[model samples]
Target: MKNFKILNNYSIRSKLIIIYLFCVLIPMIVTNSIVYITIKSNEVREQRITMEHAIERVKYNLSSVLDDCVLVSNHLHNDITLNDFITRRYDNLLDYYERYNYLLQNNVINYYYNSQHVYQVTIYTDNDTISNSSNFRKLTSETRQSEWYRQFYNNNEDMTISVYYDDNRKNYGINNTARTISITRKLDNFDKTHENILKIDVDYNVILNDILNEKMEDNLYVCNKSYILFSNKKSNVGTEEFDTIDSIEEKDVKLNDFFRFKVANEAWNIIITANEVSPLSKIVERKEILFGLAIFNLLLPTIIIILVSHSIGYRVTLLGIYLGKVENEEFSTIEYNDGQDEIGKLIRSYNLMVLRIKELIEVVFKRDAEKQRLELAKKQAELKALQSQVNPHFMFNTLESIRMRSLIKGESETAEIIENLSALLRKTINWGEDYITIEDEMLFVENYLQIQKYRFGEKLTFSFYVMGDCKGIRIPKLSILSFVENACVHGIEEVSHNASINVSIFKYDSRLFIEISDTGSGMEEDQLNLIRDKLRNAEIDMLNNSKSTGVLNTYMRLQMYCNNNMQFEIDSKPKEGTDVTIQIFLDEPGVSNSFVKENQNNNF
Candidate 1:
């Protein structure tokens, strides 16, 4: 009873009221401002989107109407009874012609001359002018002469885009105030006895009504090339929608790119405005209630909250440390406790997440590069072994030739072969990164050509031109040299000195292009096909060999470093020449000019 008296003091009530005012008022001001701004932004975005979609819907409606008009015109354009109606003689074709006009007037057009049913078409012939219909009839009709008419006449009476004050206005005089968008196209030439122009006057109101008077609970307006066609503002039709009738600005909004264009392609625009107070008013009410509740119940809840804050001081400190680490994005370690309290469980879960993140960082970022380095070392060794075998084979083969020549009546032409072979062997065993400057690689090819020239004697000739800016560019080991060796082995066996090799490297438009041409027995289509199949299957062996062993290992290494869009082109003709084109993108992806990850810390 004494503690209750202490808790019920005026000082405690005043403190609680101050706490409530500070806490609730700050949050209310902030929350209300934030809520107000967020809702306004979203409303703007949603209104813009809805406006764009509404404009599209309007265009679609207009386009559909135009399509219906075209369908009717196309049918009448090929009509058979049209010729009889234009001749102004209702013979055996009156019923057929009346039916034609009826089909045209499905819901839109209702005009004819010598048309038995509705409004009349007036025409002036060389002899007389006449128009006769059920509701509207004329006897001495003056020729329909106007600038609009002559434009159609000179255009072979094809079509004129015009609007009408009324769909029922067939000629010069009509009292109706309503209007329509229409097209008029001639069915045949004026000289012939055939149907003249087919006139289409469609009601544009139905289309405008659907979008302009939409029940969106938002105001929508639509504009055309000439005027604001309609709006929900209770303005009259044909009222221009915007004061700025400039071209439809691409409002930087995401829009669907489908254009169901209306005839004459009168591009339309839309603007949307939604009611603002509806959404935000609720937020305002919520803030008021929360603030009022905080005021009324202020004292008791505050005393209880203060007691809890003092009791949980240590736990709050621990949470603050953990939150600091999280803000720094360093989750190397975390604290855990065995207790089943909410705070204990939270710390335990957080520690588990930190361990999982460490493992994922290892897997996601580091594994691929480690695997590549190991595979690269293995391939280099394997290729070196294979390259070692080549030297001995060529040595034995050349010695055998020299012995054969010496046994006969030779002047030691084999001496030249021995020297060329020695130079080729030394260059081919490049013991470094699979890359070398173009200058170094060309020297290797020169030695290869010397060997080939010795073996084939005067039967083979070689010419190489390393062109502008291509001299010192780095390429994979043996790229051109290997091709020279291949040509020596395959092409020069049959032809004479005309059987040539030309190594030309020219840098063009920031790319490295190599053309290796040989003039011996060029490959057949079948052989080229076989080679392409082999090249396509080049990656399959590496993918299949889990051990990552290979011949042409340098080739595979270069390919791995190239972009996916890198290319090789082979052109050949039987007995002419074979041109092997290798196009290397200098800025190829995954193949940086400088070592980007060179200084990556050894984070063991």
Candidate 2:
């Protein structure tokens, strides 16, 4: 419990490192150690078993060679022709040679050709009839006392097998040298009276090659009870003695770290020494590599834990700082990173709480100030309404008095002008209404042109072409009239020649297009561009400063009322004319339905 409390006091990074070391690294090391030890134990047992089997295999192959030699000797000893050749007495030496040649061809050569390992087969006899021939020789006292001969004679068994070095060039006049394993047996007549010797020499190198080919890394020694007969190591063949065994029949004996096994029917033992390092030494050699791998395994998890813990802890610390700010009543919102994890959600929720709190506090603190602002706005609106109400009424009444006076004085043209001015004033006052129909706007434009025509006399001529159903298509009030006024003052008035103004309204699909053209003094390129730039930027102050307020004001008002759904453009050239176009998209259901109804009524 105390350790747990201590761990809790540390940061998350340290805690993660400690936990990974105990939970992941320690267990992995323990498991690997157990597995390595188990594998080493199995390897040692397998190595020992493998060496014992090798020794047995060698023993079997050597026994096979010795058995073949014994079989050949037995066959030779029982041959009647060989026994006759050995015992028969002949008078002439030449006659004895002929008989010996016959025996050599039919008996000795046949045996030699039949056996794969037998290098030669020979017979030695004490008889005076048998001369030394290719296959037989007289048995001398010196030959009978030779080491191999004595060994065979002293055995007293039917046959004896031993390995000795023989030169075929000196013994049988063959072109070969071999370490040979010889099998010797005593031969007797059919009556079992006298005896001769039959010997079969087998190529020991051939037998050993077949048996010991696979055990190149091991040392094999074939030894009898007294001395080593043949060995893979040539230096030890004649000099090495058989190590004393506690039991002659010991199957597999471990002596001086070498394994020894005895041949089945012979006194010989096959000693095998494996050319392999001890298991413990191998483990020690690879200890550094294992340690390095273990360290890398532990370090990999440590790094990953450190990185993850740092990320989480950093985000949490940032959240804490934001919370502290809130506690101090700063009420600032954190810049949300838009992460979708738990921390992101927490930050978003905290920002929402701060916004709600800010809104509540604003309401509580600024309530009285907001009320005063509203009261002031109300008074200003009333004053504007009073000014709007009294001015238009006074202007209308004055214009009516002037029209009556002119009619009474027989000035009917002047009276008609006064009436047109009063109508324009009334339309201008009604501009406070947000929207007016195309027909109402067109009527206002006509009234405006009448006043201009009266002023210009015969110099100003105008035409209106209202194409398609344009009656109830609602647009911002004063949108069309402002451009009409511009055409009169700038386009028509400046040209000295008689000028014409054309106002065209047409509907194409769901949009209404209006064009106002005047054949008057148009602007230069630079002046036209300047006016265009000012209107495009909705620079009302700049336009008023430059005495081009009407078009700029109309453009801004159209933008404000139409949410910029209307298109406005002005095209002009010096002394030719000016064309101003306004395109209004009629996509709203209220406006479209009103226009459709108005069109139906007109058609009916």
Output the number of the TM-score-best candidate. 1
TM-score of each candidate?
0.40, 0.38
Query: Model 1: per-residue lDDT, tens digit, 1-604?
Result: 2233332223434545655665566556755666666576766677667767676676666567666665555555565544334445444445545754764565223432222211223222322222344321222223245433444455453445444334233333332224445456665543355334555555454555565555565555555445444556553343222333343334532332333334443345555554444345545556765576456456555665564444344555776797688788777455545334455556677788878877877895478788899999999999999978766666667766775666566556666556566666655554567666678888888877787677677778899899745666666677777777767766777655458899888877656788898987888999888666656667746546534223235345556656443577777888887888877776445654421232122110
Local distance difference test, candidate 1:
0.57
Error (Å) of candidate 2 at residue 494 is 2.1
TM-score of 1: 0.40
Clashing pairs in 2: none
lDDT of 1 at 197: 52
Local lDDT at 501 for model 2: 91
Estimate the Cα RMSD of every predicted model relative to the unseen true structure: 17.2, 38.3
Model 2: number of clashes? 0
**lDDT tens digits by residue: candidate 2, 96-199:** 87886786577554755476777777788888676776567678898786766887877776667755554433344342444455777778636366557877
Any idea what lDDT model 2 has? 0.70
